[model samples]
Target: MFKSLLISALFVLSSQVIAATATNIAESAEQVSPLLPGLAVPNIELKDQYGKTVSLAERFKEKTTVLIVYRGGWCPYCSKQLANVQKIEKELADLGAQIIAVSPDSPEKLAESKITSPNYQLLSDDSLLLAQKLGLAFYLDDKTAKIYRNKLGVNFVSLEGEVKVALPVPAVFVIDTNGLVNFQYANPNYKVRLTEDLLLAAVKSVSEQ
Candidate 1:
């Protein structure tokens, strides 16, 4: 009887340890990706350069959408990426893909950041509603925020004149007509970007499928 009881107690202790480890693993895995491919993306509302409200889902219905989320126009990296995207705009359109660039910039700042093409829609996410829904928004450190406002002259403020609280992770998502994410590129490093060649390849794959 004593031996049997010891075995039973050991088994119970092992089971408890296993359960605790499993719970820890699950909690650790909760650091979700900002955007996951093969999932339906957030259908958040945004405004165009002209301040006209637009629905992301509505755009998906018309064609395959290449969604580019960037920092504000003040970032040279973002500006270069925008220009590169414009160069590939026609080719993507031929494949029934449209590029929409969304930034945390206000509509007024968006106007200043125009890429000189009506085909590429520059949308504003000043409220960060879309970013938060996608799990991509992160708050900057107080020191960095102060530098952006003071030295950089970027003044990361929303249209409502509230100081900027959060910024989206620079990312690109290729959405299918069904509003599902087909491909995505997200980088925590601000200087890096998804190459146009890779973007074209993703679009081609979607088009063929």
Candidate 2:
């Protein structure tokens, strides 16, 4: 009986702690304007996997920009997100929108990402300058960093591999033609993502605005 009681108590306490952490993360997320409106998308040049220098900000012209930042092609969650985004491409285009995915992976990896699901364009943020400017990026913890290096074979060093670049929290944004983000979703955990319905709603709202 005592052992059972102890186990129950521990479970309750762990549940409370997890809930508290989630609440705190959510509250902090709301408080921090890592994303701001009215500010134009960061003007940075990134090369596509095909080695063409592409200006990110320039791509937003004449349409709403749906910017999706993912950790890498290695993440299955990112793959699902891309698949969902692709599913809504026609609708998004009808709403005068385009989707661009930016990541800290190499051009080769971006190519692989395209091969996996070829709908939207992918940009290589190998230098991570754009992520730094956007403030949605973070480096992996030591444990995960090692996992990425050894197990995942994600060679950030080989790409532009000098200083460690933080991975971009998977984020989705609906930016209007004016370059203002009308809606945004971000989370550190890769499993979670913005639903297509929510994103479509955002696009519709932005279009109306």
Best by lDDT: 1
State the lDDT at 207 in candidate 1.
95
**Candidate 2 clashes between residue pairs 3 or more apart in a chain or in different chains:** 138-166, 157-161
Compared with the true structure, all predictions reach lDDT values of 0.77, 0.71
- Clashing pairs for model 1 are none
For candidate 1, the per-residue lDDT at 183 reads 94
Off by over 4 Å in 2: 1-33, 114-119, 155-165
Worst 10 residues of 1 by lDDT: 21-30
What are the per-model C-alpha RMSD values against the true structure? 11.5, 14.1
- For candidate 2, write residues 1-209 as lDDT tens digits: 99999999999998876654331111122232346655666678998888889887677766788998887787788888887888889888888788888887788777765443333689888765676566665555557677788766653421222333246667888877666768878776668899898998888988886
